[model samples]
Target: MTEPTGLGMSKVARILMVEDDEDDYILTSDSLEQLDSYQFDIHWVTNPKVAVEKLSQEEFDICLLDFQLGAQSGLDVLRQAIKLGCMTPIIMLTGQDDDNLDKLAQDAGAVDYINKEDISTGRFARAIRYALARNEVASERLERLKAETQNRSKDRFLAHLSHELRTPLTSILGYTELLLQGEKAKESRSELNIILSNGKHLLSLLNDVLDLSKIAADKLELNPSEINLDSFIADVFYLLQINAQDKGLSLVITAPQALPERIRADSTRLRQILINLSYNAIKFTDHGQVAIKLWTEWVEQKELLFFEVADTGIGIPAERLASIFKPFEQVEDIVTRKEGGAGLGLAICTELARRMGGELSVESELGKGSRFRFAIEPGDISDVPRSELHFVKADTNQDNEHYDPLQGRVLVVDDAPDIRQLVQKICDGFGLQVVTAENGLQAVQMCNESLSLDTPFTLVLMDIHMPVLGGRQAIAQIREAGFTAPVIALTAAALKGVKRSLVDIGFSDVLHKPINKKALYQCMSMHLAAQESGEQIDEVEPHILLVEDDVDAAEVSKMLLESLGAKVTLAFTGAECLAVLQSSLPVCKILLDLHLPDTDGLSLAAQIRTISPELEIVVVSGAQIEASQLSALNISRSLLKPLNLSTLQSLID
Candidate 1:
């Protein structure tokens, strides 16, 4: 701990006096002693160098220095002490009353200039008190500035680290997706699916941790929009349906018909809060169900919608409930440890809700499960514009998707070989001949060369950070030279204001790293003339063998698949699955469940694979599925319980 240096308190002042004359020192000490406001402890140092050392190293309330130190300069001592980072209050004592000398003394780092001839208790004490007080204020400001500098450094470090992490992850996820989207996707997709799933999971974990860091620093930013309540609730339920199914639990949502259709809020953050809370509920609960209920409460003339996520899981004990919302806090139990989390879900959820003009509260019985609730003001229908539709469904039907012919080639620029090649592959798939550049410097040169030859590149996918030249500077050079092709920034940095800043700095658009293939395609298509959208083809009805233990859930899922035009054959038990596979039914895919009353789900999968080695098997269960388990059973991929129809349709079709 740092020692207190009499920071304006009614206490004894520790003073250091550097004066060669014994008579002057005695006179100055007597003046300070006559002050009724303070007691003084004076230490005398005659040597200028010693005075400098003492001021620099010792903790004192104030220092009194003589202008002339017999053959040494008092000004030299003050300069040296200040240079050495002294925080003590320093007052220069002078025999001469020259205005120039007083100004010089004050400018040389002294808090005040006091004349020896005008030595009086009141005047000396006034100067001493003011110096001490100003010094304390300066010290506090310095500390605060140092703290701010450290925080900025920390944010920069996180950004750099995020970039480094996302670089390799981009390669991993990029190649995995490419392979999955390839002609031989049927052959290697199962193994690649593991890599893709885990890679995305790791990304989510990274984002969650980064969110905590930003929130702790009070820098977490929210982008609010007029969101359709219908879509928001559907998405939350769709995302977490798997978690509920992993343990044979029902994930349900109940909202009144009178519920508002739209709300002005940060939909992404709101979704994150619900997902985290509901996932936490599923993690702690061993059986039963997780339900999301919505109602309205009007208070103070404002319409507030109350959302409750209740689960029949092992609930929190009363004492520990308070700390459960704290970062890195978790209930100490075998289930919690085994379920595995960084104990950040609930903490982040509660904070997110509070930050969004709402408060999250929870109630639980130790063994009966928990109910998490929060409320937010719902906006009226006028919040959403007519042009803005609430639900815009994507054409997941690959058969109906088509691309037009490309009119020009693209330039793929990146320092990473993996990314450049990955993008090249994607561009090639888009039926556009692609050129490559290692950095922005190379990109600028190639772009100019192409333009000079009357064959300028159509679009430039530029990496932000490169060795020879960074994307921002290079793009500026390109734009200055009159190259007007759309140059999209491919970066790993997702720092706040990055996109807008990039746009301001000449980038046409921004495509973040750990490259989402779909997002990249969309971004590219917006600028480049897309050659061919997937042409409409005759629909191929997938013959699926869905083996689920819950008959009701299975029936609902089967109907959804059939509605998507799939010929679904449902099996309630593992034995029933084998019997179907043994029959001459053209079963292209099998959605297997790990939990079944008759036999082990894994054993059943192994049996089916042995009977028909070419048949694709997908696991649908509530428990966490491991890569090793999938590899062992020759399982293509595992879908979490309560499958979203679009995701299921895309997988089967």
Candidate 2:
């Protein structure tokens, strides 16, 4: 509703003077005429009503109004001009120099206030130019703020959508895992695999969408940690190798002979980026090869870790490359439709790379191939051996020893019957007894009863979310009832910080769902051997403490110790073992796993020696430490994993 611009007038000063006094109007005209820089064309209105009408009809560079009119004041004319919706700048001309009147005149939309005696052409021109520039700046700022607010609203909606999608996806993946493991009918294996695969694919897509929303809103953050890049990439590649084999494509990994053992990066997100690009390459390529190469290069005085994933099947058209990195955009073709994605992978990768202080780019040609390359700033190197070099493939049948020496019951609590049955079946396969509970409340009552009967459960597997008395609350109540058994949290919520939160909520450990049978067995074995039995015995059996962080290694050692007629108590980390010893647990010897997650074995042994001077400490590790080193730590014996049972028995005797 404001005035458009200057009216159809020549290059001259156009002024509207709203004053009823004849002398004041003549004085203003004569004052303007004294300025020879520009010609003056003045329009005089005698009343406030006529001033408003002229403001609506004609455009003027500025308006000058006398403070006192015949029956109305200059403030009245100022308000009328503003009400008529003309943006023409106004300067109030007053006979008396009063501060209050000047304030009132500006507040009513006058650009500036001037006394009639002080008015000059130069002062009027400056006020008009300043007002126009200030209004334009304010308008631009308001528009920008509005756009930012709308974008934030959209990001919040996307985050909410992610949470809603994950809740159901959890159930889908968990049940599929149960069926895949427990269903003995070979005919159903392929079908179960398909269900599991598609569910995981859906999860990946949902995560990509949420990631894009985060990057767009500048909310994505990095959590950097030391990572063994060689071992990590091998593991990521091994996962997708089967898909390549199925598609009749060769999968290749090329790396330098001696890459740095460790680099600083957000391992999870780094792995995610690689996996997404690798999956996309394999999905689009048919009867071709996928190559992943890793190397390091110096860029701008900083070492950049470079990764490239290339394929040999189909390549993008030249015109489509730019748009492919845009959200929800893809090459329109039958192949794209058949692949079936929302086209968020490359867009997310580009943003993630940028956030990591790097860039992602591509090179491709139609019907030839495409290569995606990315690099990021590499941080300090570690002296520890590369994980691939130190890694030893575990013996799957290491627990084939038919000792079954330890006798205790486990409590399996889950609302899903399929999960409970599947876990029970696995426990049964390993020759352990299990009791089932449909919810956390039922599990708590069972635990309390078992303790009162002097037959405490060895382990509790509690699901995190359920209908009645959720897992966290149930654990708190159990702890209050003085039950001290290790409770593992079995959760479908695998988001970041979930594991830390579960531990803080008093869970001994966490296991993400769509369970791996081997991992489940390792978790149960580790916790089940966590403490010695409270039962009294006639003859004192050697109560040995086994402290090891790796569950498979701990399980193997537990079987060996039990076979040697020693009751074993397992602790997964240095802190847990120290906590156990502080509780005055009866111990004759300690079989300590030196590679503890929280502390090194030698350091832990020294600490243990200081606290328990009479206790015998033995170092157990997958790593090779020298005999002299063990002596320096004041340790008598050291045992290597893939343990020698005969040697262990002789030492125990």
Candidate 3:
């Protein structure tokens, strides 16, 4: 048999020939040496025992075994090699009439079985080359799979650890806020502030870790809404003002005076993307200004809103700009080690921009600074009545003192005793009449009794999942009974389904579990205004109709939504969707899965629009939906699975 060239040029591939006959062994070796490109060094063994011994001592690239080797068959040697994890490819040579031996050789781990009478130089060489190439490809695939599994395990562990850390961190922040507000000792006050600040910083790090995990898993979601460009930029400036001030840098924002007030985008994600870019800009710029410029351009009938964050800092080298966006990659190795970051900010921003149907690019010079620009298509901006913009701004104190609304009744319901006590203490500290319930049933009973006494509950803090009668069920019953109090679902379950179910079950609002003190106060203050107005609050929970064809996944997701208190109607196909729309349940939002066996998601969304053009539709797909398709469908939001609970909550909120 002829050996192939290029196969053994580097470290010559060793081959073991196991044959009992001396004549056959010499002939095989002569044939291999005579080939034009044959470079392998052949080791001839007269017995199977000697061949096995050589295999144990040497690493051969390929093995050629004769079917007949005295009493010891080639099959025996092949089995022994396989048992020892010998991955070398083996080719078995057999007599033309020895069909049984050829079959047995293959069953024992020989890669290929060839007949000696039929073997030619061309066929023999081609077979060897094919075997080696196949082995290499298999090895590569195995290595890749191993690496992927390791990464996934690490991600899962981090996610679980972060979740555990959040629980106590929430309590620490809660107690610290109380101490900071109450009449604590002066010395203790300063220490509490330090504690609060450190806690907040740690919380931010934890959030970053969670966000990174979500991005890696492709579970990060965007909740796009129409945002006023001027107002949005103003808010961003307000948020970054402190950072810029600390660095003694000038930060400027410039936009057209009459620029479109509304652009369709995910506000939180947009804020995150901008914050990362702006902070980097400010961090690097020690002496110069960091300017953010916004403009709108119409390119080929698409309205692209462009933003540029230009900083006059120590800029990146021209050659390193491309590599800067890679995860854990920075301009220089020392820059990352000194600057203290996972070097993932830019990478995350780039990915977020891509998900928002835009591209993020940068231009910089070594001595000057860098300019990072990204653009997203402008969303539909309908005229909002002037009256809706009239919101009362809370008074700010020079001392950053907490504002406590006096003598209000507050109800707190939660499964965790620590969380219940925490809420009660905060409310009592505010001088409010606080009532506590361990579960939803007690909460409902208290609400009913308060109504009878003509001192109806001012507000109800209901936990989503309780021992008897969950938050959603209790809220629905209370609302059905004409109780006008604002019921907020306080839940620790951050899953999308849980939040959606809470909203669906007719709660006034949802505050994610492990509640933030500031967020709780804000909710209370807003609801109190509604209570004073004496307006009969309508139980108008947003309706989200999920259209998906995968039965098992759909059922599980539906249950999750129900847990979140969302009234969900599932349609397995486009035909089902059309039928549902015909029946007349007004849907506030629709979650459309793109790939369906019966009909496509995009087509279903279009059909829904034909019925109710104003219906909010969120496209759900396993694959990334292109910008072109989103524009064509007029889809405001797109969620990729496994879906993020926070993104879904933001959309409904």
Candidate 4:
């Protein structure tokens, strides 16, 4: 060019060459001279110190620095240029191939590196272009990371805020429920129901917001467990059936008779997905039906199980389907507005499916129907031993049911006076004798006294977090004191894996607050049924071989069993039980405590099976073993301690 052009108007690249060797400089100059893209204006700096100063003093499109510069290395100059706040992209030229030096050069802020042995006109030009592009990308990535960090901080703050908000909301809901139960006036009950309904709706909104935040921050985790696929889907359908009925729609579940009996999946998330889709279908549909079908498909050599919720509702127009899964992007129409959602359910579901190695998809026709489906590979599916499955009647509205008199005493422990009173009132209304404690310390003390007074607690509802002592420590003390009435954990913390953790830490079950009266009664009624049945013994008394290591425990158990009119032969260890079994004595039942001085309960049970396969084996222990696990071990029945006298009698009979 005859005249120098401004950078904004120029096709030439202003380049800086930093090298001490004259021959290397000449080679680089020759390479630049042959570039096809643009003309190069070279500014040569032989000294490393001058190179950094030149970079800081003048603007350049790109810089090429040799790895070896006399007594100094190009990495030092690259660092100096970066420290001087030079924004130009830098490429390092090395005489020999060294991956370590290349990494060092990049770490010192070099965008790209090339070996002098492989240098050519085209190669040199391509390196410059790549270096410039890489630098731009790095800058963009830094900005994106900063934005994400800020967004994550905001999400965490919101989640903490929402949890704090729920603490009071739980109390409000609890009191509202208590009032609704007590209010006899029709108008008062109606008003209370409205309050309870709105309270629950608000709680649902908060949960959805928190879930969205967790998913955005990538803090949501999968908790896979063995689930009976047929039962699980059936349960979900049953739950939503009422909703569909209220909306004048039919809810149905279609599945093959045989499914993967036990598929390992995050049952909670799966339930959440089904509930969201089914509820939405019912909500949007004025009439017609909602059907759920589960089947497996093999795709790309992978076995994927599919769950589909198809609704004959007001379907989305074909054009709007693309944006349905986008957060807060519901169809901008009067009907969608009337549906009343923040438009986050589908987005959250989509993210959850993707995180769990699955995909959520939809198919729709305007004014026809919509089908939302998600599928996951059975990589986590667990093989559950095949057995006859027992189905418990759905316990959705047990409090409203006409239950047989709750003929048992239950201990309710919580720090909240209102909560304690509420539980007491509910239990008393069901004809259950209720004793209340304000803290774990009192609960443990009461349990000890009850066992001593021959009025052992039928069930204990223990709060997890309380003053003086926590439920965990209290349960430990109670167990140490030989008290094992089933202790269910009552808490306001509905955290993931909390149920399993509570069970692991000596809880028979978990009830989240503000407690559902129906759920609480359902849980309590199951244990109480055993107590009520134990009162009337129809079968002949069982001759029992009771194996217990603890002296006090053995004596107490013997007394309890004898009270049921059963003959007891006490065995203090596994060896003692074997010795007794080897004899000609008729041992009709073996009540085995899992923890023994000589061997574990499982091994002892297995050994006993070999000796007498038909003998009834009742595993009584403080250990946490799931029902499925107990079944697999061939144990006929397992009971959690401190023992319920009535349950013991029924099991023995």
Candidate 5:
């Protein structure tokens, strides 16, 4: 053949021959001899023991093992060689015809199984070439998996460090601000302000790094909902207008007439992107306006939401524009010198845009202005025409911080002493009496103890993570204990989508840690005002236990009961039903099916009453039920299957 073939590689190919018969070794050598592109060095060993010793050294690239060996088979040598850290590729050879031997040979770590009768020049050469190619691919895959695992470990370490850093920063910033509020030591006020400002900047940077870590680890999730564009855009402008106005810069909002009025997106993430970009524009501009405009682009048949933040501030130079969006990379110019930043805003915004099925790009002219554009495929869009809107500056705050103090009692739960005292001081300013608990278990006990005295907390501020008991479980127990006051979660966990999780776990509202007094005050005021006006959460649904052997029938009955506003638990056997009762859960009634798999339904009723005498038991079945039998067991009622909605409704009532 021409230059070379696969078996005739450029380098010398080392082959190990493990054969008891000398004739087979010669035939194997002759077949490989057909390819002459490179030299082939074959090491022959007639003893299986000697073959294993040579193979263990890994000095050969490939091994050819014959199935027929004296006393011991070649498969044993192959397996032993593999067990001793051998990486050499192996091909099993047999002299006789046997169908099952091929599978057995391959199963014992041989790369291929070949018959000596089929040892043609081309076939034998191709078999050796395929084995080597496969080994190379497998080695490459192992390295890739190792790299990915290391990356994940690094991400986790970064996240833990960020969280640990925030805990101490919270107390430092909280106390500094509190001291400044009282006009304590007029001469030291400026120095205290400096500490507060720098602490906040550091906190902001920590948040940025943590967010990127979460995104990189694929831990960040998005929850999109329909939003009214008019209010959403107006709110963004209103929030930033004050910051812009303070610096003599204008915040402008504009939209093209063709833009849709409503779209589906995660409002929190969208707001974060808009705020970061617009705030940067404000911070950079000395005395010009930051304009945010919205439009749409048609890609194929789908419409994409296109928005731009154009600022008439100091523009980026041509050479630095390429690296401006890179994380931790800032365009080092006069403007950047005056307004220092972590340089993570644009990088984070770009990543979040991609997660929403879009991209972010920018254009700028030196000493003129910069324009940042973002386009996203909004999950859903409406055809309604958008109303024209313009930005107006938000009103400034008054100097004095005074309020009509609320008259009520509040319980604050936290593991940290500093946080507990800080919250107590804030609540004192509101004129609300305060109670504190170091952990969730203690908080539940305090609430129960207070209830016995005819005095209970008007509101609860609970921390999410704690020792002994967690906030979620504590709140559940609080609810079980008949405490219906509004419970607000105080958390330091700032991961995206955490607020939704807290709310679903029965929290009325979520307040992030390194707490802002303004936000906390507003949340407390809103919740307390609602409580004062007799507006409370709806009554708890009555719990019912339904025991049925048929899974389909049990599910149907559970659904029907839930439709009538009752919480139903279904058990397919008497044992499961008994376990449920033993938990001491508040059950209003028990629905029993007369047909049984383990024991009679009526017999199970006797055990149910022993756990709770007040829990009424109702028997359900076809014409197999009789009223006289149910009355004998002190069972409440007897009803037929394919339940009547009215009868089920009466049971819960």
Candidate 6:
């Protein structure tokens, strides 16, 4: 033990002694006072209740307890101290060798035990110091455990919330698509727009939650790249301007005249930190301005950049400012109601700054305003000259050009009349030759008649499920009868095997139901170009084919394709096409449906592919395909139900 010097006494450990017996209290205090080593100040309390009260009112280095304290026992005092989170070490003193009382006192919260008779000044002083050290270790352990448990709970909650949000959002986007396609009333469009906006906001919230969780778990990796700091800051400012304006707040940014032209940093993380701080400033400030100031400094002879965000608004109380960086801690209880947040913004910012080899600090005065600042080592930018700096404004109204493909002969086949008409109209818009059939039998007859007249059908769009000779069976039969053509599968079956299985059987490719014009054109352009390159075209039209079971759906899809300059032929079933092919009709391309009344679409697609591997077969269905099945069937692309035209065109082309 080290003896107390003038300096040591200034930092001397203080101990509190609790005992009902005045003599016992004096003896303990004197024993500790006589110690020639470490310095300590002992406060005595003859009443156990008073000792517990004193422990709460002030801080102490350790506690000494006498087990027998008149009517009140030392255990009662220990319990009270423990309940109040008095983490100071405690040594239990007993008059007699009562192991039971010692055990009780230790269990109640005492850090160690010593018999009163064994109380030498030297031994007592040593015991007090040892116990105090041990108590500090135990308290730290408990705090760490508590923090870990809390982090795990928060992560689980975020994951569950994300899952719940995605479910409803999917439906909202789906319905909105339907409405935008003119399937819903015009009056409901406004409501749909509102839903879309809210859905976007919800998605943004989910993204923030995920980002925060990743940061907390130390899994948020930054991709540092060379960036112009001035330009980067300007972009962040521009994006956050709308948010500030919405809150009726003014946002101002100030940068040095000769700022660094380039810096190597994680642009995304830096942007996130700035955005969070600025957003909070704007959120808290009901009026006045939120100003962002940038500057540089020399710390330890290292060039460092500092950013400060200050706002004129209601500031945080001094006492509460320390806790503002704690997760789920907000300055006001009504913060969730007045301004919505999970109280994670500042916490995340703090961690982010620490990760960047710096720390975040704040200064504020209640009823005035607050300023937050962080510093980071400036990255090398000596290679970039000031003259090269240029400001590029973002365009607000730029739109992507719609890609359109040349239309060729297309086929529409389904049991529904409305669908066929819809498809015909869309194809007609693009100057495509549109043909339709109710079932496989009718389709085979038309192909046979064309072959007899020396004018073979260009393409066959076969429906999967029809009254007779369904799409798959018709495709297989057409292949068996010696017709080599590309077959595209179009059906509403969203089962795992629906897409790949169709390709395996004989279809060239798969498309989903409720087709969009853009997707249709893209698909047609890709496969059509392949077939027209003098590649071995399947007996059906080599360019494009559509296979759908639903009549209205098939027609709509056909119309969309035709609107893109495609010619189409419709077929209802596999057997009907088989009959025609058996009669020696030569068609270029075939669009086969997956869910046929006669046979499985995948099996038919496989069989067809086996006969004509060079033929382009695309399966169009309303089902989601599994990666395993896709690998097994060797099919690359698949479209979901209510397919988007742009996506379709991309896949096929």
Give candidates' CA RMSD values in order: 25.9, 20.6, 13.2, 18.9, 12.4, 22.7
Give the total clashing residue pairs for model 6: 90
lDDT of 6 by residue, 1-653 (tens): 12246654423667787877787777776777666455677777788778888888777777788887888778888899899977677788988887787788778878778888877645666786677566557766667768867976986676566545554554555446545546445777667766765665665566566667777566666567887776787787877787889888889888664668777777767887888888788878888999998876777876777899999978888878889998787655533357777777788788878877678999998878899999775576455554322445443212133455355666677666655665566556556687888877776666555555444545555657667778876776666555555567656443333554565456666765544455556666666677778564333333354656555567776776666666554444555434333322333445566676676557766766665555455566668767676556555555666755775556445
Which ranges of candidate 6 are over 4 A from the true structure?
A: 1-160, 164-200, 228-231, 334-337, 387-391, 396-653
> What's the true lDDT of residue 189 in model 4?
71
Cα lDDT tens digits, model 3, 1-653, are: 22245555433456788877777777667666654443667887877777777777666767888887787777888899788777778898877666676677778889888776545566666776677567667767667778767876976576457546665775887777766656655568768867876787677666666666678766676778877655677667866777899999999887653466557789877887787889889888888799988776776776677888999988887778889898778654624344666677788888888888788999998779889999776675434321122122232111265666655788898766777888898677567788899887888788888887856678888766567887766776677577777888775444334444455446677787456766777877777777888764444444578888766568777777777678788888887766555532447788888898787888877887898787778888878889898888788879888765675667667
Tens-place lDDT per residue, model 2, 1-653, is 12323654223657788888898888778877765444667888897888888988887767877888876787877787788787777888888889999899989998788877675656755664465445445555656667866875875576456545655665677657655645463588778778878898888877777677667656666889887665676677767888899999999987764567778889868888889889888988886799988877888877788899999868898878888898888643523577677778888888888878689999998788889999977685435343333332232212333434335688889887767877776677677778999898998899889887767788788887776888877887787687888788887554455665466446778886656566777776666665564532222344688898766577787898788777877788998777656542467889887677799888888889887887888877777779888877677788776677887887688
lDDT of 1: 0.78
TM-score of every candidate relative to the true structure = 0.69, 0.51, 0.57, 0.44, 0.55, 0.38
Better of 3 and 4 by lDDT: 4
Candidate 6, residue 26: the lDDT equals 70
Per candidate, the number of residue pairs that clash is 19, 0, 14, 3, 0, 90
Model 5: clashing residue pairs? none
- Model 6 TM-score, 2 decimals: 0.38
The TM-score ranking, best first, is 1, 3, 5, 2, 4, 6
For model 1, the superposed segments whose C-alpha errors exceed 4 Å read 1-14, 19-49, 67-76, 79-87, 94-109, 187-191, 216-219, 224-235, 248-250, 256-267, 296-299, 331-339, 376-378, 382-406, 528-653
**Collision pairs in model 2:** none
